[model samples]
Target chain A: MTIKTSNAGVTVIKKLFSRHETFVFLAIVIFGLIITVVNPDFLTLENVFDLLKSYALMGTFAVGMLFVLISGGIDISFTAIATITGYVIAVLLLQNGEQLNIVSVFAIAGGVGVLLGIINALIIYYFNIPSIITTIATLNIYYGLLTVISKGKWLYGFPAWFGQYTQMYVFKFTAANGTSYGLSVITAFWFVLMLIAWFVLRYTVLGRSIYAMGGNSASAKRAGFNLLRLNLFVYGFMGLMAGFGSVIQALLVQTVAPNSLVGKELDVVAAVVLGGASLTGGTGSVLGTFLGVVLIAIMGNGLTLMRVPAFWYKVVIGTVILISVGASAYRRKVSARRRTIIEVE
Target chain B: MERKYSEFLVLFFILLGVIGLMWLLNGSTFMSLNNFRSMAFQLPELGILSMAMMIAMLTSGINLSIIATANLAGIIMALILTQTIPPEATGPGGIGLVILAILAGLLVAAAIGLLNGFLIAHLEISPILATLGTMILVSGLALAITKGYVVSGFPPAMRAIGNSTILGLPVPILIFAAGAVILSVILQRTSLGARIYMLGSNPLACFYSGVNNPRVLMSTYLISGLYSGVAAIVMISRFNSAKADYGESYLLLTVLVSVLGGVSAAGGFGRVSGLILGLIILQIISNGLNLMGVNTFLTVALWGMVLIAVMVLQFLLNRYKEKRRSI
Candidate 1:
């Protein structure tokens, strides 16, 4: 009887391990434990909260990237989009001596993002340009235009209410060491956004059409899916996420530097790809993306706790991305070779 | 052949038009010999890098790691030169050490290219992802070694490689010219060249025809790596320093130049002559902008706009040609 129950438990564990998200989750747990073993502070509630707070921006961007990748395109320009909107809005607020209104800020930022994203979609579809090529050009155009207009200026000294809004937390607790810990409002926003993305991707026709388009664009078109509309929605959604993420970044860092956000597009791309999104498109998940972000956060935090060189973080992230993507590609090739096709013809 | 000639003709005229515009805008300043000389010097590093990118794109692949590979190789060479030889030394011994350093750097680049090729071809990883991974990893390695410091103080002879004039032309430009000739010969005259075009145009067809796709791809990246190594040599010599972050902006510029040269992004098409025309056009525009004292950021924006504009033009031309053919 014990053996039978143990066998059932083994099957359950095996089934869970079969999932990519579960594998990433397990890696995160193991990595976290190893870090805790090295530095007990790594597992502390304060540090945990700090990790979530720091990685919230990346997580938000990863969600946005997931939408684009699932729709069978890539957009490296989102970083430029984010910086342009965020910087322009902050500069405008500073010039006009206006207070930060949360609703207005988001509306303006997100609206700008949607506008840019629609332009990207229009240029791409109308010209039949490759998504990567279009985005690369736009990445330069947006970033260059921003720098030219702003003279590469940085913005600080946000309104008092913006600072106060950032300090608000969903919950707070005192740790055993008498240190207070709380997840910030921005982190909570990340969670809410992730949940919304998960719901939209899992249950919406828009999401299904995106997957269908990515899986096979020709088939999706034949099935009556509007490729142009899908392109607009996905790119536009990506812009919205970038806008939200930019706000979150500003909230965390309390500064808007135009140049800081452009080059880090790779990190966001790495996170989403690590989450099992194929560059070729048509495959990704919210859970998997969340776990991917967690894995990176854990590795980054753990390395810092262990006093590893900051540069090593890039090496680790790069290796992790290559290994994960290579493994998946190998698995796909093997599956393709092993599949049995019925000889109906 | 006639169509290809017309394409070149159009690019040549565009180059002349750009030069004419620059002359119209800046006149004597743009027409100055000193300005022309400086532009010639500046063009080679970027020009060589564009060729490297074009070669990879020819195989329907890209080496996003090209800049990173160049930096790492240059870093390695810098380390060797700095460690082995004293600063500003110009003896025969120094020349020998420089040669050793150059070869060693090229070897390092080749190894990186081999690794990228392995990941993309053998492991079947997509070129973008594979090269991106290598790019990050290599750049991190470079940063870890240098700790974000610039490596400088090469022997005078090495510096001369960048600054010296020979036969009334800059040595670097001469190098670029020679490299272009060699590359053109390799692409147009060799079996490897044919295989590259075939592979880029259709990999499965190439494979089924008994060509070794993996080997062809490996060679393609290896050649790309060597070109980047050469570009690094030019860059470091020109600046008299090597840094992990050097030429970050050149990545997009190289892409722009290649596409402007009429290299198909989907691959299987491009020419050295067209690329040279593209380089000349860009060089003139850049030189003109500097002479006019336009904002550098605006120049970058202009490059982006030019890239899009050229792409749009290509699309229209292709559509028009197809319509004519159908009629």
Candidate 2:
């Protein structure tokens, strides 16, 4: 009897886990497996590091965006902010003419990001313009401003220290023939940032407030929440992350182009939605977004391995977005109908 | 009394401001007949799209799929005219062929719009999400059909309709005027239009009052789709080529024009006259920028700032009205 009870408990736990996000997580893992099998080199330490480096900056932006989306708002201009701040840093480096330090670049980029975020927060919080429309407008404005400031020039010739900083290894392992593999400092930083973001969203008071506001702003307001202040902080946080993201991006690529991040907002939004954030606001998790990013990256990696046409990727991404959102909507209808039936019963 | 005119007043001021900027930057060139004529011709396609958006807004549903539908229809029309229509009978038979082509486009757009309405109104999907799905599907179909190539070789008469001037005004401008008149009458004088406004303002209340909410919702989307078809015709005529990507740029511009024209984004309130003025304001801004030789990239920034200012002004005006009502 005791053995049977224990086995049943294990089955129950497995069933519960399988019900939510488990399917998606399993899908991602299978995708990774398929890619690795298709190209044995895909599982190499060096290739893994390359993949991590490619996604690090975008992952950071996704972290910040998770906060905004959880609070029932979105920042389409985040990527634009990243590009603009990167350009600013590029300009400063050029003007400094070999005298630039990493600290200076970081400071300029962070400041610009915060400033832009504040502007976005102010308009959205105070004026009551829909976040979607406001962000769309600002996305264009920010990119345009970047173009004007840069005069359509690419920024290159970064200091060797900056490059080394991005590529610095946190840990190294030697295989048989003295070949070494290592995790870069940037990847390590990204992992830590994502973990902290996860903690904040899961455990903090402000984090709870974000969920509360997203779930129902009326109740939150009645409960004495300072919505305007929260709005500012949320947008500002996104901006700061975007700034940091830009710095990492600059370091990784060793160059900045004004149009580098064009049309990237859609990708971030897609990842967020795929992770289960409702566009109607409230009800998502940081872990979900992270998983979302992972899933997208895996899809791209898998498609490339299979040599799928580039255009088909758009079709796939668009289809995924439609299906996920459609499923969510259908689920809501089912639940609502169930509630009505129970009430009638 | 003056408060009732506030929206129009603000729009008029914006128009004057744009005109004054044009004068400051390009003096004589800005006011030249040729430039004005060109602006007139270019305004109609966007104008039609904005009008379509307004109809959707009145029903509290947005059709982001308008551009997609327009693109699909334009491509189909071009393909039929260029590859399918025979050469010898291209004159009178071409007229019949063009009408048939337009009918087919309208049917396709209407079908897509109906699907959108069904999903949004009956199935209880969010309007934005529902329309976005259709936007993707329709645009994909357009791209697939054309393989992303421009279809040209429209007959001369159709080209003439695109290029002809009437009473010193371009044909597109004339079409725009006709559309504005017809739509304004429909919106203000018809019971169906009133029912749409009622449904948009409060659906539950409208239903309780015996309105067929689903029918109203479906018809609004259908009308918007019809307008999209009309816009596609004008677009093909003006450009003399049809491309799947042709309508992509107009999506944002259409929404901007509709919202900035005093059409409430929350729906149930708008005027065709206001939309017409809004289109003109946007066109003048674009044309003025051309004359001033402003960098293309900066145009987005400039427009964003202008939109924000207009939004702020609208917010303040609405607040002022509420304050007065409370007093």
Candidate 3:
């Protein structure tokens, strides 16, 4: 009877949360606890809000990245895509100056995203190139074109509403000690998008197809999945978010520069991979991703609080990607072994 | 093999065409001997890095840490020259000390490659992630050592590698050509080259055939490390300085040069002659565009476009071949 209950418990854990994710979740908790112990201010409401806001842009695109990775490809070019879309929107807004409405801003970003997304999708899927190689080239092309045309132009002094639009608080409060805390629209957008991602991934045919394709593409195709159409949508949808993400960033920075974010795609990729999205694709969760973002944001904030050299952060993030991805690969092997054992039994 | 030579021919003509276009656009100034000399000087650093990348890619693997490894290696050599050797040292002993430094720097670069090999071959991590990790760690170590400042003032013998020309050809070019020939021999004329090609073609098959897959994998990255060492020595000598961030831009461009040279990113297919032609084509396009007063950024864009064009061309060629085979 004890063995039966233990077997059931194992089954339960396996079904609800895979063993690898359980490890990741524990790592996040332990990391958070360590940060809190090192600096109790880390748990403060204001710091929490601040951390969320800081990683909000990365959080937005990490979801888009989740979509791509789940479909068995990777994109480092989204940063370039975001820059192009954001830079265009910033220039247009600056040129129009207070006359531009918000609707058109989103429309333009989304439209541009869809177009570029199709191009990205076509190159990766239709041309049968490795996604990383294709995206690397496009990243160069997109950023290069922007740099040439703009000559490293910086767009500044966005209309007041632009910043306010993203920062419009969904909730706000002031403590007796005068520490104000609030949830901004950006964080709310991130949360809502997380829930939306969970819903789409868990409930939609599109999500199922993507997951199926990523797991075993040949079998998925045999199962009647349309590789061309599905990948086009996946990449296209990412571009749409890139467009939206650029506007969000423009809102935050208030001064948009063309090449400032060129090399930071590594951070986004790190965050998504840390969030438990396998680089080989077909596994990840909204909750895993949210925790990953939270941990990254806190790690950055906590390290700054500790006054560690800023230069070392790149090294730290790179280590995190390696360790996490390495653990996943190890776990994958272990799980395969476990399957063989179970079959033998 | 025939298709390989065809790519070489095509790239050779493209190089000539780019030079002609530049001459037409900018007249005789673009065709001057000085301009050609500078272009040759510029090609070796990029050419060497691309050679390292081609070697890594030949195994259907990549070492994204090439630039970082080169920079790190360069920093080591710089440190030896600037810190160990006395400023006034310029005799036979000084040359001996410089040679020691070069060997030490090469050793460090090879050590890093060994680590990459261990990660990929032993730890079984993907090459991209494995090298990306090392690239970060190595560059961080570099930054820490130099404190983000440039290390300069090497012995003249060391500087001469970058500055001195040998028999009408630049030393750097000579070095680049030597590295290429050695690699070509390794790839085309040796049992080791056959093993590497077989490993890249199918690691599983190689393992089944008892090819000592891990050792082959280790040697490929080891070769990349050796190449980085050579490139680093050249870079340090040419610029007469070293920094953590030097040659950061060359990272992607090397990949472009290799892929554009008809080296398959999926591995098991590449040629040294093809890569050389690709390097020439890029140099001409870049030098020509510079002569035309084009923005440096636009030239970057042009390289990206060229990569895409090559991809499309390959796709069409594959389709046509498939159709012919089917008929």
User: Model 2, range A201-275, lDDT digits (tens) per residue?
Assistant: 789888888888888888999999999988888899899888989999888888998767876776777777778
List candidate 1 segments past 4 Å from native.
A1-17, A95-100, A176-179, A340-345, B85-93
Task: List model 1 lDDT by residue over B281-323, tens digit each.
Answer: 8888888888899988888888888888888888888899999
Return the TM-scores of chain A for each candidate in numbered order.
Answer: 0.94, 0.90, 0.93
Model 1: how far residue B153 lies from native, Å = 1.2
Please give the TM-score that candidate 3 achieves against the real structure. 0.94
lDDT of model 3 at position A238: 86
Docking verdict class for candidate 3: medium
Tens-digit lDDT string for candidate 3 (A1-345): 888879988899777665556766787778778878888888888888877876888898888888888888877788888889988888888788588787788789878977888899999887888787888888889889988878788889877777677557889989899977789888888788888888999999988998988888889999999999989988998888788788778877787888767888867766777777875548877777777777678777877776777777667766776787777777777788899999999
TM-score of chain B of each: 0.97, 0.94, 0.97
How large is the interface RMSD of each prediction?
A: 1.1, 2.0, 1.7
Give the per-residue lDDT of model 1 (tens digit) for A35-138. Answer: 99999989877888988988999999899999998887889999999998889668756766365588788788889998989989998888887777788888
What lDDT does candidate 1 reach at residue A157? 86
Best by lDDT: 1
Task: Tally clashes: model 1.
Answer: 0
For candidate 1, the TM-score of chain A alone relative to the native chain A: 0.94
The candidate, 1 or 3, that scores higher on DockQ is 1
Evaluate all candidate structures by whole-model CA lDDT and list the values in order.
0.87, 0.79, 0.84
Model 2, B21: alpha-carbon shift in Å? 5.6
